[model samples]
Target: MSTSDPYVDLRSRAFAIAYQMLGSVGEAEDVMQEAFLRLHRTQRDGETIASPRAYIATLVTRLAIDQWRSARARREQYVGEWLPEPLAADPSPGEHAETADSLSLAVLVLLETLTPQQRAAFLLREVFDYPYTEVAEIIGTDVDTTRHLVARARRRVRERRPRYHATRQQQRRLAGRFFAAVEHGDLPALEELLAQDVAMHGDGGGRVPALGRPLNGRQPVARVLAAMAPLLARAGGVRFDLTKVNGQPGALVFDTRGLLVAVMALDITDGHIQTIHSIVNPDKLQHFGRVGNLGDLVRADPDPTGDA
Candidate 1:
């Protein structure tokens, strides 16, 4: 790869599209590598490329759609709730609000409801600001068909997307208060930070114990957290570090040995926590660093004396 090659500069943009389309960093990276390889081969064969950007984007979109189709069956058989692999950083923060929101774990989860072609069209048109004609070219559909795909996807997303959006500063502050309440086992404070219909989702991939279904309602969610606070403390060597996950206020949990054990992303709205997404599946945490055996943490012995 030459430093002067435009592909070098387009890597990040290409990654943003691939990641959003596939919702898996590893898979998106694989798509990028393959796309670049093809590009290199074509150039080496003395082919004249008019627009490297559009050409690469088309390659990435098509490749990601294929990957998504193949992965569908595996995801269908996955144990427990399924969540997109959490992204540790925002790909492009200066982009428009729609692009930023599209990166959220919440939105990505909702995007799973659409067909692969619909998802590609929607992301290209709505999030990346691609025109319908270009989106049609990328997805290999007629312009009218592409418009229909985008409209249908937009409708589906609108029905499920978060109604309220929070600023980064607000998310950090609320997340701090929410986590503090959890750490201290303050039931009232925890409940105060959550909305009336708040929900908590956990994805353990059947390797560790997790909520088989989303736990809903503020009181139920708060009670569970309060009960787990002492258990987590008793587990010993557990640490929680505040950080960003999927462009939202979240935390990275580590064991005594400093291995990542889990990730938690919060969805805040109207100055309250609306949803909590927790990923404890070891397979998903490998990208972060070494992963600890979460089962050990979850299996910690409780106080035998009727006090716990």
Candidate 2:
């Protein structure tokens, strides 16, 4: 990919829109490829595009909307909790603090509650900072209708959004302590780090065992994590690497063979962990790296004692 390549210049912006809209890296990349192909075909046909950037944005948004409609049904039928694919934190052009927040796994989960059109309108206006007139044009709706869509989506997001915001340093420090506790099975330390109302959501996608419902409150979440830590350690070959997921503090779990087993994203706020999102579904982990067979690993013989 040459820096001078037009697609190279537009990839970041186009992917930001598509990924936020669909919450699936694979699907967003598909939309981006299709958009680029369309742009190329149009140029070959001697059609003039006044603004290639805007045209690609519109193409990606509309395509993502269509993809989301189809994906929603599959999600409804999904065996276990559905979560957006975990995104590795990589700096990209035009990605400011606000843009990163909107890309967080927590916000993506809230965006799932929105209708396709509402999600598109809201993201364009709120996250990407697109004007109302341009948003209406992109979504093929009247300005008034677009406003209504954004308004409804905004209200819903506001109601569910995290009330406390943590600076990056605060998040990293808190998350470090949280993961350290989990690894050492320190129940008290874990409890101290978690918020009173903290919740933990796991997405195993029915391929592996996971909590069928979210575990709420500090005590329950702490106990479950503490118990599991020793079990994982005894199983052998399990390692945890701290990294950023969707611009927030997170950790990646790998098996004995160093294949990815899970991606955990911590929602830290006000110096405590507000929520914990663990993605164990292999399908979702594929985008991050080689996914280990979590089921097989869990089924293997346990060391009976926490030994290497």
Candidate 3:
């Protein structure tokens, strides 16, 4: 089997770029297909591409940029909240570091704020470590413009980022405490774990009775949790399973009937859970069959194993 293709090794990389840019597996796969088509059509013309991987990357980025623009418009028309698509675990630990670091859930969600060019430039430089000149070529822009775009994008990210420095260790700890509070239905414990200005947002698309708008302030969040306690107690012995959503610590819950119920994600700031994103809308939980890990489960219900 002699194949004249160097890009066989690059599909995952191309897919990664598209997924980060478009936030949809289907869209990413479509963009990658288009990129490969372009390569097949252009390579036969005796065009000398230094790196097939880089060439394909440019094509995927362009396609994803267009898709992102349209998606943003659709999100604006959405009935309620809009959320980033969730991702499952890699299952392969060897590839984990690359996928985990590049697709940090919070970072991907934040990248939604950038313009296509800004996002391409910033991600290439920051995530891929590409030089300005190289990134300029990848994005089909001049180096000066690419530099400026990356700079502006970086500044915007810094400004919008939570005040506390985010680290995997701190996120793990906060997730642990969150599970403890939810399991016990302790408002004070829950309140103490959340920042005073903590907020929770969910994009269940009106199917689930979410807060509709972002729940701000610890008091309001506490009240909501308290109100849900009886329902959680009565809801067919539901259990939470800790999982990673989009590579961040989160949870997925299932009722006793073995039906998926909720997907919860969080953003930790200053050692407290600053944002609690609970996705109770059933329509959105179709792709994910299970939570990412134990942290992901416990956040949804106290019993992740569904044995309770």
- For residues 71-135, write the lDDT of model 1, one tens digit per residue: 88889998889988898776564687787778889999999999999999999999889999999
CA error at residue 33 for candidate 1, angstroms:
0.9
User: Candidate 2 lDDT (Cα, whole model)?
Assistant: 0.85
Clashes of each: 0, 0, 16
lDDT of candidate 2 over 221-262, digit per residue (tens): 888888777567667847788888987799998889989988
Better of 2 and 3 by TM-score: 2
Cα error, candidate 2, residue 123 (Å): 0.5
Superposed Cα deviation of residue 28, candidate 3 (Å): 2.1
Q: Rate the local accuracy (lDDT) of all candidates.
A: 0.86, 0.85, 0.72
Q: After superposition, how far is residue 121 of candidate 1 from its true place, in Å?
A: 0.4
RMSD to native for every prediction?
3.2, 3.5, 6.1
* True-vs-predicted CA distance for residue 11, candidate 3, Å: 2.4
Candidate 1 yields a Cα-based lDDT of 0.86
Per-residue lDDT over 28-70 for candidate 3, one digit per residue giving the tens place of the 0 to 100 score: 8889998998888887887877788778878888888888899
